[model samples]
Target: MEKLRIVFMGTPDFAVGILDTIYQNNYEIVGVITAPDKPAGRGQKVSTSAVKEYAVSKNLHLLQPTNLKSEDFLAELKSLNANLHVVVAFRMLPEVVWKMPKLGTFNLHASLLPEYRGAAPINWAIINGETKTGVTTFFIDDKIDTGAMIMSKELFIGDEESAGELHDRLMHLGSDAVVETLQLIETGKASTTIQAENDEIKTAYKLNKENCKIDWSQSGKMIFDQIRGLSPYPAAWTFIKDGENEWNVKIYAASFEAKEHDELVGKISTTKKEIFIATKDGILKIVSLQFPGKKRMLAHELLNGISFSENTIAL
Candidate 1:
């Protein structure tokens, strides 16, 4: 078996955990590849990726390439002489980059192989009302996430779990998977199998503004899941019209009452300490929410300062 000289490639905060786990386990991480720093937020100050910040802190050899296909970048990558490549939460790789390493490139996915394969797996799993999801480590192939599977670890979803919560759990779960996958690869025992084909597979399409809008027409349970699935980030939102003065409101946390109701689906009723929106099957009780230009807070706190008139309706 070849001695492990690994090249790590990833960008978001989720990738940091997996990268750190490998570093802590005494792996020879010869190089780290992350995204280039760019301006962000209202202030527009330059911001580095989470992985870049961590890599700098550890003084690891780092490279932020604007183009993975460039000859210069490829030349630098080749000089690293890495035998193994580990990817997580990163962009799709060009064949030249992924195929360079001796033992081949493998990725840690947030969902099981051939399922929930896309940009936002954790959010879609919860948004689709799935009760279970897991992490998978697989060797890289030409296709995205259709690689031969090495190993997977499953986890049950809580009834009220948000994507943020599930993301953290999966990150830790990925740590264990990384160690096992490395052991298998280095020991020459990593027997990968082709992914199972299923016609009923679900995809995690990327989240955008159009899809993030909350549809009151959906059942209360579905709306509840939608809110939780996208919570603590790009939240589900609706137009709150209070006596003709309308504004967008983002719902972060909520509870639902699944029952037969005659009220209009988008009708909004409010109390001094509560806000309820009627849905297809029942009422959706808002727990945490954010109004335009304000931070997210408890529902009751919002109701305290902003009272909706009788014309209250969530559009």
Candidate 2:
């Protein structure tokens, strides 16, 4: 069979893995569509998208368009005459573009369809305390992540795994799945399954700073999941009164102490080794944290200098 002409669209590290897999397998990638470069960081230096960096290294034809529907970019996309367009970790494509390909456009979503079907699926799945999360590839439609499924694969989430750990696992799995899907498509053996809409839908919208505040009123298990879900990035935070000035601290790693606390919820119970905060059901022993203007450090290290008074409470 003739090699299928593929156009890849993606912007982040998650997408790079699948792109590399396609190249390794000798698939014909006619063009790559990625986000345009923008100024980033304190220095405001211009930075390219992750997909752009990889495309540059591989000498792939790339298009970085700010406007997807612009006539020139649309013409460029049509000029490629690609058989399939694969989208992973990329922006939403309009019908004019996604419908242009002969084999149609498909997206690789981080979570199974009809669940966790928004921007940050991996983080939200861990945050919501899901026992299992998987990846899916589906045909692109008008709604976000609501398309019919082409392929689905399940992955187990360990009890003690963090979001970052799960991300790495899924990234590797997703790469292989995409390549397999491509091979099946080329051989006219690809099978598609329609997604069912049920009441069990859980959205994984983008995380915001305001949503990272720890709610002490929640149960210890809920709070624990929330902390781990946001750990290492957009961390779960709480405020404490520091000499009449409120200080915000982000908690990265914590475990439930399974202790009975006589203190009220949101009260701090600390020792030289750990810092436990009373929750609705139990206590949360914070192991790692980051305070304002300071790097992330262990709870014991922070307690060494940032002392908590006998009557202090974590708001």
Candidate 3:
């Protein structure tokens, strides 16, 4: 068997776990490629990607490519002379790059192949109210997430799980799956199944402010799903008004009751200790939220500081 020399590619904290798993297993990581350092957060401070930090901490050869197709970047990638490439949470690869490795490149996607095949799989799966989502390791092709599957493993989605929670679980599961795939490839025992075309697949559309905005007219369950799906990042939001003052609020946690309610849609009902919003068919209780210029807090804690009148409505 030919010894495997790997080049790993990814950004974000999610990829760090998988890359660590491979390194711990003693893979010959020839080079690491990640997005360049860029400004982030309220301070606009330059930040290095999670992958870069891990690579540097372990003294791995690293490349920060601004353009995947640039001659310099390509030459650097080629110089690594790696047989395999493993990508997780990385940007799309040009043909020249994905096809460069002798053992070919593979990607670890957060969702099962042929479903939720896009950028925001974790968020979309919870938003769509899926009971199950999983991880897949597949040979990278020219198209996005449409690749020959080497292995897949299933995980049950908890009814109360947020995208952040699910993301952590999938990251660990993916680490295991990727390690298994690497072993199969190294031993020449891998058998890949080509992904089939399916129009009914639910896509993980890129998240944006437009989609993150909360709509009170939706059913309590739907609005609830939206909240958890977007929680911890790009949180679901709404405009809350107390007849006199309106505040755009970011909702991080909530529960829902599907019973019919006479309260006007978007109405915010508050007891001394809790807050609930009327939806199309029921009520959504606000658990954790943030007000503009304020940190996130429980609804009751927020109410202690800022009261909501009976006329208050979540717009």
Candidate 4:
């Protein structure tokens, strides 16, 4: 069979793996569509998307368009004469672009379709204490993540795994699934299932400061899951209050122990080497944290530099 003329679209590190897999397998990637470079970081230097960097190294035909529907960009995309367009961690495409290709466009979503179908699937899944989550490849439609599914792969979530860890695993799993889906399309064996509508569907909306705050009024396990789910990026945060001095702190790691206690929720218990906070059901032991203007460190190391009195509370 003739190699499929694929146009790959993506931006982040997660998308790079799938692009590499397709290229390494000798698939014909006619073009790559990625986000334009933007100024970033303390130095304000221009930064390229991970997909752009990989495309550059491989000498692939690349297009970085700020406006997806602009006539000039649309013409350039049309000139490629791609058979199919594969979107991973990329922005939403206008119909003029996604529907231009002969075989149509498809997206590789981080979570199983009809559930957790939003921007931050991996993080929200862990935050909601889901024990299993998976990736799905679905045909692109007018709505977001509400498309016909071509394929899916499931995986178990480790009991203590953080969001960052689960992200890496899904990145590779998504790469393999993309390859398999493409192969099926090449052989004219591809099939799709329409996603069913359900009111009980869980949505993975974007996370923000309001949602990332730790709520001490919740159970120890619930709070622990929240901390782990957002760890290492947009982490779960709380205010540490000592007398009149209050500072915002991001908690990166913690463990929970269900012990019946009369301590008020949000109360803090501290020692020379450990710090525990009372929650609705039990106590949560902070393992690592980052204070404002400070790097992340172990709880013991942070304890050495700061002292918490019995009256201390995490507000």
Per-residue alpha-carbon lDDT of model 1 for 202-257, expressed as tens digits?
A: 88999998788998888889999999999887999999887758899899999998
lDDT of prediction 1: 0.93
Query: Which candidate would rank higher by lDDT, 2 or 4?
Result: 4
Q: After superposition, how far is residue 33 of candidate 1 from its true place, in Å?
A: 0.3
Per-residue C-alpha lDDT of model 3 across residues 1-315, encoded as one tens digit per residue: 779999999999999999999999999999999999999999999999999999999999999989999999999899989999999999999999999999999999999988989999999999999999999999999999998999999999999999999999999999999999999999999999988887798899999999999887777898999999999999999998887798889999999988876889998888888998888888888999999999999988898898777899888
- TM-score for every candidate vs. truth? 0.98, 0.95, 0.98, 0.97
The global C-alpha lDDT for each of the candidates, from Candidate 1 onward, is 0.93, 0.87, 0.93, 0.92
lDDT order, best first, reads 3, 1, 4, 2
Instruction: Identify the runs in model 4 with alpha carbons over 4 angstroms from their true place.
Output: none
- Please list all clashing residue pairs in model 1, or write none if there are none: none
| Candidate 4 TM-score to native | 0.97
Kindly give the number of clashing pairs for every candidate.
0, 0, 0, 0
What lDDT score goes with residue 226 in model 4?
93
Clashes of 3: 0
